[model samples]
Target chain A: MAEYAAQGKLPEVLFFVGCAGSFDDRAKKITKAFVKLLNKANIDFAVLGTEESCNGDPAKRAGNEFLFQMQAMTNIEVLNGYGIKKIVTTCPHCFNTIGNEYPELGGKYEVMHHTQFLKSLLKEGRLKVEGGKFKGKKITFHDPCYLGRANGEYEAPRNLLEKLEVELVEMKRNKSNGMCCGAGGAQMFKDAEPGDKEINVARTEQAQETSAEIIATGCPFCMVMMTDGVKAKNAEENLQVMDIAEMIASADDL
Target chain B: MQYIPNILFIIALAAGIGYFTFNIRKIIRNIKLGQKVDASDHKSQRWSNVFRIALGQSKMVVRPIPGLLHIFVYVGFVIINIEVLEIIIDGIFGTHRVLSTVLPTGLYNFLIASFEILAFLVLVGVILFWTRRNIQKLKRFWAREMKGWPKNDGNIILYFEMVLMILFLTMNAADQSLQSLGVAHYVEAGSFPISQFIVPFFDGLSEGTLMVIERSAWWLHILGILAFLNYLYFSKHLHILLAFPNVYFGRVVPQGKFKNLASVTAEVKMMMDPDADPFAAPDEDATEAPAKFGASDVMDLSTTQLLGAYTCTECGRCTSVCPANMTGKLLSPRKIMMDTRDRLEEVGRNIDKNGEFKPDDKQLLNDYILPEELWACTTCNACVEACPVSIEPMSIIMDMRQYLVMEQSAAPQELNTAMTNIENNGAPWPYNQQDRLNWMDEN
Candidate 1:
């Protein structure tokens, strides 16, 4: 946001590279994939760069409302100062909190999850997926709780995946009744509570039951949990967990 | 000598109403133990919500079979109370068939016949409910959380209804026999469509014997109703009275919308102002703001949340759908509401014992609801969606989490690390702020 302000002009949209996208070794691949796609589509976008901070979704979900507010206020100040309006994020958690929770704190803006933004780009003919390498692979989409149930968005990611021309199998509990990947509400920051089986394990099992070669998700958090579940089940070699952006980026040869 | 019956009737009436009033006072007092909240917004919408959810049983019917069965009990309980009003009048004035005198014979018969049909249906519903709980053993009712008091409380209410319905039919049968005998004051009233089947069982009884049976059944029926009324405070049956107000005052916004704290918003607004001094000294008047960030005990929660606790029916619908609970986690949304009510009751008792709540060292947070359980919650709002009374268990969980994170700084180690990363690097990762753009350089 600060970088754009210094240029005396605004980009078409602010790309909110969330914490995981910015730093996590695995998530950084997704970030690169999405950024390459944006570049190939010739869409004008700018990153917050060093000026960006956590969207505070994890803090808020973990019950640290004060920390969440502090982080949110800082981000809102920078965005408002830059006169930023449209924001597109690769993380559903960021999309959910910024789109839904920020307005109450007086930071209102049009925020779109990356899947929706990508779908819009496709609709506008700015991007195209030719299924270069993923033509006939069996793929299944895992619904992130925030994107699917919390925010009523189950189609954008799936629609993007459909462009890949994959089999696109679905788990039993899909759409509004989609099971959580067990990392929501800040559970990613803590050990699993006492239970007979981990929620991610159960969710991964459901995905595996679909016999899909790849489990596609829209959120970085879902990717992490689902990946861990696949690894725990010793099925990592056969089943790969991926973000919709990564698949689309690969298929489009970005 | 004639005044004896009227005098006895007045005494029974006073005792029943008097005890019921006392219990109502206790409930109000206990609920008042929590903090106040302004749920007075959206008047027209709230009214419609009450009508649709409480009166219409809209949410209840989502499960079809059980939902329809519950509607039978709910509708039966409500319509049958009209008969209770007539009983109250009779108990107070010693009137026999006063409603019969007021209405034409046909209308009176129609009303009696409808009540009889409802009574029979209510009996069938109650019996089916009992079988579902005990015999069929629905997994929800048999969940680990439904042990002890919750289990017994459910069964006891079903039994109470069965007994009440039986007494109602028995009283009607005795009255039918006495009316046939042309007994004075028996007053050939009431179309005993349901109880007429019971008339055969009382065939050999003498007129005097039938009179004793009728009067005893009448007394028992009224007394049983009073007992049931009082028992509501202790059992989950309190939902019968509270579901209306709870649904009416439920959150009007979408499930995902979390309201920002007003004080935090104000502080943020001031900080965003370019002209405002960054290092301005804190205003003395602003010190009056609450010292804590979120709820730790009953007194910290809003009155609507407290009312939600009291209104819980202990039907494990919330827990059954909860992702954490379904995955075998310790979190149960139903238990969260139960713990809140238990803590609120404890606080009320403390106030009663010591004139003010003395610090009990125990709070709704760690003492009753373990942090493990709270942490296990995915905040999916399944519990709120499944609740028939519109209770939002997620609100309480969020409030307590705020307390844990802000007041005590007692968040899990991983969260602390993530929060620290956000503070230093502008994100939840350990990478430096300057490195955030590195992803853009990749590939």
Candidate 2:
């Protein structure tokens, strides 16, 4: 994100991340890296503290329309008043809501899920990655529904994975056929519906079958679900779920 | 009570049969003019849906008041057919033994008594149906949603139904009178309380008068059935004929996926380079014209979709499950199908009668369905999943979105920004392409 700012290719904007932005120790490290990037480039930004609202993704899904509209409008007013024309969110739910769904209430702005924005910066010479220091890392990409089907942007994160010297093992049902992370439709906040297994747990099993070292995805919601899935299947030691952003931040700097 | 009434029933029966036959033929021709329904790969005879929907009367069972009433009326029709045959045979041949041989004397008399009782129940049911439709004015009725030729059709059906009910009752009254007068004999007459009550009126009637009344009653009842059948085609009650075939041909699979796009010839030819492997490069883009990816108008729909619109029983089951509708969003899957049917009928009427179809003349997009309604859909399969008939509303919504975005460039404003980001940077963010791997460099 800083590299793009350094090159004057990306806009300078305030960033508002959701609670899952700082999930665990590993996520904290990646968030620091992002902050470090911002500091190095001297880019202007602010993180929304606990005051950041839920965005009502859960309420909207559960048919609680009253709460969704109120929460949406509140966020809209706050963001619009702040003159935050562009919002970069680590959470796909936040990105999809602010970018896609909020427009119905007359709140419109430029929004990007972080991987898409980061992938773009990598494609341009504005950001350079030192590569090939560690080779033969077998990796499989998980397509988050919001990033792929709902939004129709699928290829950039895959290309970024390839550029990171990661072996890109394609899933059989990649792209539009990608399975949900069991977090969509606000399933993340509430207990899952009655079923023999969680969808994410099933998806993680699909990933583990690939024998990849790392399970990489774009959305924070997917990150949380996939991680829980890995734990549930008792494959936490054998398998791992990491956001593509965190993996990219791990690359050996030139 | 008199021979004149029986004579009137006979004349009415003859006229009703002829009237119904002609109308049914006309409706058949009109429906046949539409596109042929594509054969479904998943289709098989569903005896259960037929049993539940037809004999069990489950669709009507949704509204308890009407459903219960209609059940009695429907069962009445089914049971009375035997009585109808009996009456016809008795009036023509002066013998009742033709149908009575199928069962024992006691059972036959029981069925006859049951039919007479059921006929009275049906008469009361039809009167209530008419009264409810005209007086109560239930807006949820399928007839209320209809436009064009069917605007006043609910009343017409009501009138027809009421007349048939009257004929049924009067015919039963004449039959009871004759049976009581000993003109028509049963080996074991069962308890027909209403028939027994009306029987005393014809005690002293002349033999000629009793015979004439019986014959006329039989004729009137038969003619009423014939007229009712003819009227079924024109009324919104056409669903009676269309629903069976409609349900039979309903998409067997869940309605979510779009029709497989035809191959493009240009892409096929382009792939024929020396580097091409036939197995790897299956001919996908062989489309010659800009294929209608989604429906832009009524005729833009595939024949299966057209059948879906007509097949909808207006059950509102789709609406009940639709997330958009649940969220107070403008998109109601049921309403979409209903509107599509209305638009199709309107367009067909204009084209066939006026010899012109100009979509511009009608604000079809805004008036029929707004852009907001189309966009509100999350493309969830909930509506399709819930629908018993498997009508795919999502495909229709997506197709229109495609046309709006790809052809007209009339998508929401955020799409413009997203597309720009994609076009210029190959991602949906205004960031340098080089920074795409920034996160990889840090760890």
Candidate 3:
């Protein structure tokens, strides 16, 4: 893990596989790429697979502090037992908890959202992403509050998208001020308060106003919420929410 | 001859004493009910924050026009206490203009003029605060959250302020009337400007009528302060006194961390002792009896956490800064404090009246704060960071989370599955634990 970071290679990454990211077989393929990339770079890492669980984010928010801490302590002990020092994850919820919150439970680690790792791979020239011949598609990146404000990571996904030659348009509220997808804090798993307009719906409307073909983001939570927003607005035909890696892997501008 | 003045002075004295005593008692009761004090050292290092922010009216300074207005009122309000003392003195002696005997002509005039100007500023400041809370025009800042004051509370404070201003104006008018009619100097005769304006109207008035107006204004002014002091306890304006101590003793470290679990002694009181049929232990007994993970009630919070709620100015800055709240998550940091306060208030009443302790029900989430809102928090310290008063909303969320996850073992299905996976395989998947290293090899 230490050697990989020093060489600008992927570290001994522990992936936080969340429920949303777990059900899809495509998740395996996406993670398989991550594993292949780390292997090619000779970085030491492990995937906790089903062994990696929820980071008690939902429990904590639900006023279940005991469950939150128990899960937190359990994860911390497991990570330490495995001698894991760094983490890379597809799920922003897990990523935020392990990196930002675990320390509060005496579990400190270098945790990165997967886009951060991929961006590092690109920066190191270790992973060659094939961008086929295509015109630059107008894309607006939705900054996930967890990855962006909570964790202060706003550039990795955008940098990768820019490098891919995608036309990047910004919503009125971007970066730290980015609107929420109404999927955070376990809202993805529960019904929201009764209101005519939902937050994610508002955010999708903002994305629609941007007139972008794709809403690219780094976090899976954003992907799910934005997708829901798109579906609700019936704009799925016009705007697509794609993860940065998926965009890079399939960009027409490549 | 002085009996009437003496009677009014007795009333004012009684009111002020009674009012302050009642508020102090209420504050103590609230504190005892679990308004916390953050043991974190951050508060002490910035001792000047108390004076600068609360006393100096710094937070209000963010909006200069309104800020300046408030500062004027606050300064004037404090300075007017001196005037109250003089009123009390005169009421006792049945004589006015008592201060004129000690102070130079210029000094007395300066004191009165300064107070008058300060009073004017205070009136303007309070009007703005009032309008900001009630009018739709200031909705840009006030909308969507408790921006300034709740409607009822704001109105009460505004009433106090108006009374104070009215008393000041009426007394000045009455004093001027008496002075213009060649009344003997008791306090400085030329000290009041409004009094000068009323002097012409008093030219034909009898001395007795002038004296009656003077005494009436004095009574009103003194009575206003007394009422306000008592009302401050119940009003949102409690921040006036609470903000100082809250800012003075804020958390020292980053607000994310919870206090370390309390240490237990050697005699392990295990309900699951195999010798006593471990598996047969009831759910409640299965866990440690004196379990110290989550806060079951208000008293469970540290002294500072409780204080944080009281000290909160309902600025909505916390809600505004919260990532979860911004993203449309149910979590509103401002509402969390408010709810805690509401619950704390109830808890205080329950303990005082019945001494009953009820286990927090699972519905606490749905009732106190929605489950979605509670789960929406990323444990980010943005709310903590944005708070000018240093209230750590995240800590409260985190502590409650600890209780739900650890004690109840009732978390979301996804989180439960994930946690189980982590426990059995060191990862979140169904694969062999050793294969965890395969990803590293492949990468």
Candidate 4:
């Protein structure tokens, strides 16, 4: 944000590199793949560099409203300072909080989850996917609660997945009635509540029921959860949990 | 001689109305224990919501089988109450069939015929409802949350309706018998299509015996209604009366829209303004700190939320659809609403006993709702959408979570670490902010 303000010119969009995107080992690969796609597509975008902070979605959902407000206010000030409008993020938690929750705190912007942004780019012919490596592979998409139910953007992720030329199977529970991967509402940061089964395990079982070779997700938190579920079930070697961005970047050979 | 009956009638009326009024006052006072909120917006929309959801039974019918049965009971309960108006008037004036005299013969017959049919339908509906709860054990009604008082309370209301309907039918039956015998003041008033079948039970009885049965049934029916009216204050049956107002004041925003606190927003706005002074004295109104953030007790919640607690029907639709609950999590959305109502009642009792709320070491958090249940919630709006009366259990869960984090500084350790990372490095990971752009180099 500081660099963009210094340049006195606006990029086409600001990429909000979420926490997982910035630091988590697995999620960094998704960030790199998406960044590669942007570069290949010639879409001018800039990261906030050190100016970017947590979108505070985790804090807010975890019930630390005060901390959430503090973080959101700081980010809003920087974004407004640079007059940034459109934003895209790899995490649905950030996309949801900034797109739906931020407007109430006076941080209005046109925010899109990365899958939505990728789908839009594909539609605009700025990006193309010929399924270079994933041709005819059977993949199942896991709907992150934030992107699918919270914001009703189920079509965007599915549409992007369809471009990979894979056999896109769906779990029985999908879209509006989709089950949570047990990572939402800050559950990702807490021990599982006492129950007969972990929610992620149940959700992963549903994905596995499709007998797909790949479990594709649109959010970093979901990727973490589905990966954990696959490891728990000892199916890591046979089945891979991946983000849509990683698939798209690999398909484009970027 | 007439004065004695008139005096007895007055006493019954006074006792019923007085007891009902006292309970209503207590409920109002308890609900007022909550903080105030502005549900005064979107008047027209609120009215339509009440009409659609509460009156029209729109949301209830989402599941066809039980939904249709509920409509029978709902419509029966409402339409049967029209007969109560006549009962009230008759008790006061020592008159029989007052409405019959007030309306033409055809209209009176039509009303009586309709009442008889609905009374029979209501009887059947109540029976099916009872069977579903006790015999068939519908999973929703038998969930872990519905275990003790909730279970008993549900059965009690069904039994109450059954007894009332039986009394209504028997009263009509006895009156029908008296009319056939040409007894004076029998008046040949109502059409006893349902109760006609019951007339045989009164066959061959003398005038005095028949009169006794008819009068006693009438008295019991009215008294039962009065008792049920007061019982609502203690029962989940309170939804019978509150569902209307609750739906009227339901949340109008999109399900995903979370409301931001004004005070927090104000502080943030000040910090964001580049031209503003940083060390200036705060505004006079902003001097006082908010009375703890979020809600740890009934007093911290808004009046509308308290109302939602009281209006909860404990139907378990919210729990049945909840992703957390479905996956076997400890969280049950129905239990959240029930716990809130129980805590609110406890607070009300405290105020009633001491003339003000005494400092009870117990609170809504940790006592009624555990952190496990709170943490298990996915914040999916399924609970809110599944509620027939528009109760938002997720809101209360979120608010209590806010209290746990803000007031107590007690969050799960993983969350604490993540929050710490966000505070120090501007993200939820322990990484240097300068290296945030390194993902680009990997490509």
- Residue-wise lDDT of candidate 3 within A1-254, one digit each (tens)? 33433465553466665544554343444455444556655666655553555576654555444445666776676677667777778776677767766775568888888888888887788765654431388889988767776667789878877787777999987875566676665555555654456777788899999899988876666777788889999987888887776665554232
Give every candidate's TM-score on chain A: 0.97, 0.86, 0.86, 0.97
Whole-model Cα lDDT per candidate?
A: 0.86, 0.60, 0.66, 0.86
Report residue B378 deviation for candidate 3 (angstroms). 7.6
Fnat for the candidates in order: 0.71, 0.00, 0.19, 0.66
Question: Which one is best on DockQ?
Answer: 1
TM-score of every candidate relative to the true structure: 0.89, 0.51, 0.70, 0.88
Better of 1 and 3 by lDDT: 1
Clashing pairs in 1: A53-B426
User: After superposing candidate 2, which stretches have Cα over 4 Å from the reference?
Assistant: A1-254, B1-37, B45-70, B82-104, B117-152, B155-159, B184-220, B255-258, B263-290, B312-335, B346-373, B376-407, B414-443
lDDT of 4 at B310: 97
Candidate 3 chain B weakest ten by summed lDDT:
B264-273
Superposed Cα deviation of residue B304, candidate 4 (Å): 1.6
True-structure lDDT of candidate 3: 0.66
* B296-325 per-residue lDDT for model 2 (tens digits): 676665555555666665656566545345
In model 4, which regions exceed 4 Å deviation?
A: A1-8, A28-46, A114-142, A152-176, A208-217, A235-254, B3-7, B104-107, B139-145, B189-193, B267-290, B323-329
lDDT of 4 by residue, B1-443 (tens): 87786678779878988998998889888888888878889999999999899999898887787898898888888998889999889888888889999999898888888899999888898899899899999888989889898999999999999999999999999999999999998888877788989999887899999999999999999989988988888899889888988898787765666777776777667766888898887577876765578888888888888999999989998898887888788899999999999999998888889999899999999899998888888786778878999899999999998888888887888989988887788877678888887776664
Cand. 4 Cα-lDDT: 0.86
The digit string of per-residue lDDT tens for model 3 on B171-213 reads 7877776655667753335466544565566567788887787
